[model samples]
Structure formats: C-alpha cells, structure tokens
Target: MDMIVQSLRLGEIEIPEEKLIYMERPVLGFEDYKQFCLIEIDEFKPFLWLQSTEKPAVAFLVVNPKIFVSDYKIEINSKEIAELDIENVNSVETYVVVTLSDKIENMTINLQGPILINTENQRGKQLVLVNSDYEVNYKFMTHTVEEETEVNREVPVEV
Candidate 1:
C-alpha cells in the first residue's frame, strides 16, 4: 500500500511539500552543510530563510533574484548538474544566500554563489558560477519573516 502524509514536523509544526524549500551544497567555507529547509516567517513578504538539516549549525537568508538584483544571472557547470541527476534545468529551483545586517537597508544576497536543486528528485548542489558577478553573501532585506520551509538540499545527480 502507498501511504502519503501531507506534512511532517521537524520540531513542532508540520511542514508540507508545497511549503518545503530546497538548497544546494555550500561553498568552500560552508562545505560541511548539504541538506536544508526553507521556512516562511511571513505571508506577505517574499524573503525566506534557509536552515541546514545536515549539520544543524548552518543557516542563511535567501530571496528571489527578481526582487533585488535586476540583472543577476547564474550558469552552473554541466558536470555538477550531472552529479545532481538533474535531467533538465526546469527541474531545479535556484536561491541565493543572503546576509542580514543590523539595519534593514544593509541586506544583501549572494548572486555570485547560488544554491541549485531538483525539488522533485530531492537532490541539490552548491555551485560557484565562474562568470557570476555577485558576492558570497548577498544581502537584500527590507524586513524580516519569522517562519519558512525546509527540504533536502542534496540529491544524487546520477544513479
């Protein structure tokens, strides 16, 4: 029999698949982290925070590329894409790492470094875009949210 559950609670609240957010592997400085979940702290706001499930000591704030950097673009390596078993680019969801500052105006999002993953397949990869004209910590925050979603950050690109 095939049994399906809508949402699972990591601590207390139940997180549904529709609310689950995925992240890729972290860069050299954050190599240890692999799995993460995006939790929505607000309903009106577009900003979401990433929390590491693999190590439990890692987390980052992320945002939609269209919100802050108007001309931000990222192209990942084919090998890394293959490793994640990504059959097509459409299967992947992209999110940039963010840094929150004391003042809301000082926020930034890491456009250069991005987290890529296949939400359906449950695999992910943190790739560095060689030609990306962005930073490791791109902050773009005008306000903050208290809740977000979480999902597996890494998935095998190939069998």
Candidate 2:
C-alpha cells in the first residue's frame, strides 16, 4: 500500500507502507510522533532524513556510525530490544542523529543515543547507552573534502 506523506523538506511524496517505521518507544523529546520514514537523497548519499510522518516539519539528519567510524560498536541490553520483536539479529540496523555546525569538520553525531530499527517488522526505538563511554556529541567529519576528493582522483589514475 502506498501512503502519501507531506514533508516540509521533500514536499508531498508517496511511499510504501512497508517503509513506515513505528516507534516501539518514541524518540527522545519526540514522544508525540512515533511514525517516521528514512528518506535517502541522492545528493546526500551517506546521510538520510529521519522524517516524522505525523509532523512534516520534524526531521533529523542521521547516518550509520560505521560510515566514518569503522570500528563503531555498541552493546545493547536484551530487554531494551524486546519490544522490537527481534527474531534475528541480522534484521537490526543502527543509526545516529547528526548535528550540523557552521563548519563541515565541526559536525558531530550522537553516539551515546542510537536509534535501532528492525527491518523485518519496521519497528524502532532510540536507546541511551548508559554504561558506555560513547559521547552524545562525537565529532563525525574530521577530514576535509579536498583531501578525500584528491585521494579519489589519484586512485583511478594509479589503477
């Protein structure tokens, strides 16, 4: 089934019902809205829009920590994931909210709180890692764009 969603950023769009994610436990400070959809924009490849279907204006920039921090790992309590009805661990995917700053390098991601979703059932919850050493504001973009682009340009030439 296709549901029409009105988004302030993306405008009105139709998406499959399966794409809708119902929050088992709503996002922090966003309890009123439990339904959201992860929208991926081509220009913003690594980043995604965690947009609230209930409220068009509510959206957050999110990304997988593994993209920048390859060794990013977190331990979640079994009870915390019970609501997601996880029959398989492989169905679970994690995303962290990104905070943008005036400068690109100063951008940060909330590693202490990660939003975990079960792809099978389309249910999700935001977990606060109480005992973890992760910070809420961890610097995400450390390298300059010029440095990465230059390296990419040299890669194909060398190959």
Q: Evaluated with TM-score, which candidate comes out highest?
A: 2
**Cα lDDT over the full model 1:** 0.57
What's the TM for model 1?
0.66
Residue-wise C-alpha lDDT for candidate 2, range 25-97, written one tens digit per residue: 8889999999999999999977899999999998889987766655567666667657888877767788889
Q: 1-159, model 1: which lDDT tens digit per residue?
A: 221222233233344545443444554487766555666676525766566655444556666564555445566567777666777766776677767678768867766666775766767666666765566665455534333343233222222
RMSD in Å for candidate 1, one decimal?
A: 8.0
Per-prediction RMSD in angstroms?
8.0, 7.2
Q: Please report, as a residue range, the 10-residue window in candidate 1 with the lowest summed lDDT.
A: 1-10
Off by over 4 Å in 2: 143-159
TM-score of each: 0.66, 0.87
